[model samples]
Target: MEILDWIQDWFKDNCDGNWEHGEVIQITTLDNPGWEVEIDISNTSIATMNLAWIRNDNGKEDWYGVKIENQKFTAAGDAGKLKFLLGLFKEMIDKIEA
Candidate 1:
């Protein structure tokens, strides 16, 4: 599924009023391009995750950064990295619901 679709579906399936009241997910568009995504799962079983895409970085394209657990872990990569991150989120949701 498309990332946006997955995001919507995930929220629909997981949020139970309180999560939405807490503002669990946020997305903002950068001035240049790309997006800044913040997911607050700290209240949940999983940790918080932040994702941002750099328009241009030292002549590199598709540069993205991810910080988890308030920078307890960090990574930089491309779009594929976001896909992997989403997969991890799905797994966490499944585990928590199960």
Candidate 2:
């Protein structure tokens, strides 16, 4: 699966049964062959924002930043190095909400 597909799947799995309102808003791919996927779930009671970072085999690492204000959460991760960014994301969200 492509990076975007993987990210979408991840989000779907983690959306906490809030899938229809949450959506992938924008996707931007970099020249470094890295990619960014943005998800907007603002329509819900809580505003949700997600960014995905993608990097290839090179030493460089990309970043994805996700923000959720209404529900209280923030997220980011290095795509090239981490297995899955969910841990980082949850931590970030907890910090923001806390």
Candidate 3:
């Protein structure tokens, strides 16, 4: 199946309880045939952190991202880790292109 389809299914299965609706903003395909799927949740306030497993030509790689902080989620640990994941994503994409 296509990456987009897989992502949609995965999100639907895992995030159905959290999100009411959302949209895919962009899908950047790397040279390795892997993709970066950028989705924007409509209910940003209600939306929680995304702990999805990213797969490339290599294998399954996990990533965590979100911009929300509440007592229920992410009270401890590093919230800035999301930025680091983005940076790593950029580097991986660039490397694939190069």
Candidate 4:
């Protein structure tokens, strides 16, 4: 499945009556012309997992970083990396579910 669709399904699957109130996922744009994604994993399946920072940088247009901190999955990257960032999240989720 596409990254966005997988993300949506993950979000929908994790939503409890009150979990959505705190906002499980947040996506925003950076002033450096990049994408930032933060997903709250508290009370979710992957909340207990430990993930180190994952980063790659080849140039201004080719950089991405991801980490799990404070019970949340956070990632940032160049504009073109939005889908890639979400794909990372899906991969992690897949592993946790598997």
Candidate 5:
């Protein structure tokens, strides 16, 4: 719940009127029974980050991946990983801030 609150706050923080019109964030379900998150860093604080993708595939259902493409931060994981992937994004942001 805390992470979700933080994510809402982060979204609010980035809502500069203009950025909000671009559909900067998207959370969708994948047909493969999973979640997908795409956040457009655009002119935000993390836009300049050059972080590499993160992937973990321990087994069939225990798999996830994250990466920055163009100007968007993208991630996907199994059905139960929605919050976990968000947490990973938070960790990346925290790491940058730290």
Candidate 6:
């Protein structure tokens, strides 16, 4: 999964192994045939945070809803926050390429 790889690389680059013991758990799929992803960052001292992604059942196939600490923050079409989380890694990858 590209997201997994990107997350791992992000930790390696930005977190200084703080997330070395982190895990990405695949939670149950909803009836909408959407995926649920759980990201654990408890190993880091920064904060005991857990993030989640719920694939939207609507026609917006590329969109996802985001949750932090089980609290819904962003709707499917509003991916800015999600991208910010993913962008932490994407920025590093971009630097490497630059």
Q: Which candidate is the best by TM-score?
A: 4
| Local distance difference test scores for all models | 0.56, 0.45, 0.37, 0.89, 0.86, 0.44
Clash list (residue pairs), candidate 1: none
Candidate 5 residues lying further than 4 Å off, grouped into runs, are none
TM-score of 1: 0.53
Which has the greatest lDDT? 4
Per-residue lDDT over 1-98 for candidate 3, one digit per residue giving the tens place of the 0 to 100 score: 54445445545644655453434234444443234435453433334543344322223343333232231122111232333434443343344446
Model 4 per-residue lDDT tens digits across residues 3-97:
77788888888888888899689999998899999999996878887778988999999999999988999999998989988998888888888
- In model 3, pairs of residues that clash are none
Q: List candidate 4 segments past 4 Å from native.
A: none
Superposed on all Cα atoms, model 6 deviates from the true structure by an RMSD in Å of 7.8
In angstroms, give how far residue 76 of model 4 lies from its true place: 0.2
lDDT of 6 by residue, 51-83 (tens): 465455345445456555632222223323344
The sequence of per-residue lDDT tens digits that candidate 5 reaches over residues 1-98 is 59889999988987887888987879999987899999888867678876578899877688899998788889999988999989987887888778
Return the TM-score for candidate 3, rounded to 2 decimals: 0.26
Error of 5 at 16 (Å): 1.2
Global Cα RMSD, each model: 5.8, 7.8, 14.0, 1.0, 1.4, 7.8
- Tens-digit lDDT string for candidate 1 (1-98): 77668778777776776767865776555544445566766555555444343233443436566556562223344443556555555655666679
Q: Least accurate stretch of 10 residues (summed lDDT) in model 4? A: 43-52
Task: Give the TM-score comparing model 6 with the true structure, all chains together.
Answer: 0.37
Q: Taking the tens digit of each residue's C-alpha lDDT, what string does model 2 give over 42-83?
A: 433235543343323324565555545444343334445233
Model 1: runs farther than 4 Å from truth? 48-60, 70-98
Pairs clashing within candidate 6? none
User: What's the number of clashes in each of the models?
Assistant: 0, 0, 0, 0, 0, 0
Ranking by lDDT: 4, 5, 1, 2, 6, 3
